[model samples]
Target: MSQTPNRSYADIRKALLAGEETALLDVREEAPFAEAHPLFAANIPLSKLELEVYARIPRRDTRVTVYDAGEGLAERAAHKLRDLGYVDVALLEGGLEGWRAAGGELFKDVNVPSKAFGELVESERHTPSLAAEEVKALLDAKADVVVLDARRFDEYQTMSIPTGVSVPGAELVLRVAEIAPNPATRVIVNCAGRTRSIIGTQSLVNAGIPNPVAALRNGTIGWTLAGQQLDHGQARRFSEVSEVTRRQAAEAARAVADKAGVGRASLAQLGAWQAETARTTYLFDVRTPEEYEAGHLPGARSVPGGQLVQETDHVASVRGARLVLADDDGVRANMSASWLAQMGWEVHVLDDVPASTFTQAGPWQAPLPALPATEEITPQTLADWLQEGDARVLDFTASANHVKRHIPGAWWALRGQLAEALARVPAASRYVLTCGSSLLARFAVAEVKATTGRDVYLLAGGTAAWVAAGLPVEEGEQHLASPRIDRYRRPYEGTDNPREAMQGYLDWEFGLVEQLGRDSTHGFFVI
Candidate 1:
């Protein structure tokens, strides 16, 4: 096989500076990729490269530079990209260490671009914020204040400020008028950490809403550190907006987007862009999951506005690609596009589209490469094989899922590391492959067969099917064939993270504005 060509950090930086289409991919698991990487390097782990690459970098000839932290995953990923028909693939000249050696600033945490942008917004806009203690006192006093949790509904349900209502970031501008109709009512926004809080609060401030808005300083992290009690299992959510409120929100959001230089695109223009084979264009439905599932524009991926801003790399890996955001509610898409435009994206809000035009219904489906057909076995058949000791079960599900619940005697394996995993598992006459839904496992059947020179069969419907058949299962890490590095644990996510880690995370965020200043490649400009 031909070795992948190397691209220097200087070359990548030049492209970014010039707003050229490029994909700086960190071909490592989410866990390690979050630790340290270049500012624009998107985490596209080698383990799930096939699953994510096509959807993320749609243009086959887009410039792609893969790198790793000396794990030797980059070359393998580069070769795989070539096999998958990605025409312009190369390796980072120095990998992670080389970036450091070349004096490029390495950022910590996933979604560094968004986090840094939040810090920049706070610094430039001076977004107001009240500490946890102040907000708690206001809640205790029954003051005319509303606490809005700007995280996802599930995260808000897990833990929230007492009296806090779940109004995710994008929904805030649209729902706040209804939630706090009185102009004197104080509105407070918060997230698990800081970024969303700043962005959400700033969204209202930018929109020129009548209410006095402020972010919950440091968000729930500060609330926990302040030794305050949080409401758990809370079900509070934003109510439906009246037509009056929706119109007001639409007007305000459009003004903000205009000020931020966001473009307005008609459906016809979007179609023209989609038809252009030379450029990559991503169509996203920037609405809540339920709203997206109900209906959305054809070819649009469901990426909630809040998360689309928070994790741009995950949603739009092809840097410099044209982006079109759609929302039945004008507020979310416009607000999201405003931020995206400031972050140097060529972004547009789909204009004047009626809800009925969203003819497509159901969840967004990722584009995948064609899979090879392989022999399949029913849950009962696989169970019988296990009982007869004629087959070894190799699970290609996420490590965390395997540890939580898996088929009895199944060894957790990574599809990308199949050869290594196959060597670890005890040899059998045949191997049964399964994942949560068998999506990934289906892609690995041919590779496993070639590796072991034995019959390989896929578990129809995967482990989910097994459980549905009332089959017994066991859980533990005793059968791990690959190490667990697929996901990085965020210190601010769960309730039990050590205090030091939380503080360290906050400290890192506090320094991101300075880091952005040092890097100077981000084309961010706050409105």
Candidate 2:
């Protein structure tokens, strides 16, 4: 391991306050990172270290401080990064506890930077909004108005205002005319919480949309607090854009994009930018998740403009990296890029990129690297082994996927935690591995063999192949060897969260502007 140095919280804080380039990463799962972290620290999770670090912290020499809550994870992360050719990796002196001792602030929830910026926008621009009672009254009277949910479709499905159509933040300007049609119809934007609703409403106003627009103040949280009813399982969505409306929205968005000083790049220019080895370039498709999953540029990530603005830190942890955004309809990318440019990103919109370039699609993700060589066992062979009790199966897949379907008796294990996880399982005559794709399982074969000193094998073609071959699979969290710490459960994600937790979440968001003021690291500038 490289003898990487340690960085004091005070020194890190000073560098942040001075606006020097730095990435303070919390090398823990999203749950713990959300539970508490320094305001500007981005959660990269040690499990995803190799998968995400290169793109997030683009500059190899950019100073990076990794921390955990005394979990002894930072050192391991630092070493792994060194192996990956990161030049300036360091530990946050004493980890989370050390920061606390140094009198640093700890924040709750993810995307604090974007949420804080939304508060700042409202403070500076005085964006108009309607309280729950007022919006409820409007809906009750059948006012000539349309309520647009400016969140993800799943979020809208979880809970929404009655009669509201799903029009995510980036789509507000592009699809508003089609949803309301009538120039005189009022539009009310909402999210589960405040950021998207505020930004979505402001997006229309900024784009010069004719209809009077307002945000549902405090979003669903406020509505729930006000003893109002919320709609569930609603599938209403924005209709396709008419040619005339598309042109108008595109023209308006381009104007805002220009005002924000966002640049335009041809495909060739973007390719050149991507070719540059010294800096990180993040190419995003700023359309809806469904649209992105349908098709997008091969190397581009799906961020859906509004979420890109709301979770900028999550998308690009390196403060100085360049951003290139794309959308089938130009309006979304332009609007999203405008906000990012204003927020001090070196932002641009991809122009004149051919529709053919967007042929590859289906859930944006990091491409898997080549796995280490391992002995392979056919699904039929593995099934026979299981039936004869000759081998034990471990599935190195995501907890959610493992819950959905897996080999009947397979144990779920995270590849990063394999060493510790081995203690939980019964000693087997031989070990077998599998995952949804089997690629990740292949990556772990060498590690498991080295750690356990046992013969190990990878199931050929994984669960998909097994299913294709008509093998029986079991569902649910039947054999979890590790806690499901990979993802953070958001207060607004499902219907089961306590109302008090949701309310407290909203309350915390309301105070982010104050928190941003206390933490001077954020160099945000709104247009």
The pairs that clash in candidate 1 are: none
Off by over 4 Å in 2: 10-21, 58-62, 289-298, 352-365, 476-478
Give one digit per residue, the lDDT tens place, for model 2 in 390-509.
898999878888999999999998666777788888889799998887877876788789988999999999988899999999999878888888778888666677888888888888
C-alpha RMSD for every candidate:
1.3, 2.7
Q: Pick the candidate with the highest TM-score.
A: 1
All candidates' lDDT scores?
0.92, 0.86
lDDT of 2 at 24: 92
Q: Could you tell me how far off, in angstroms, the CA of residue 437 lies in candidate 2 after the best superposition? A: 2.3
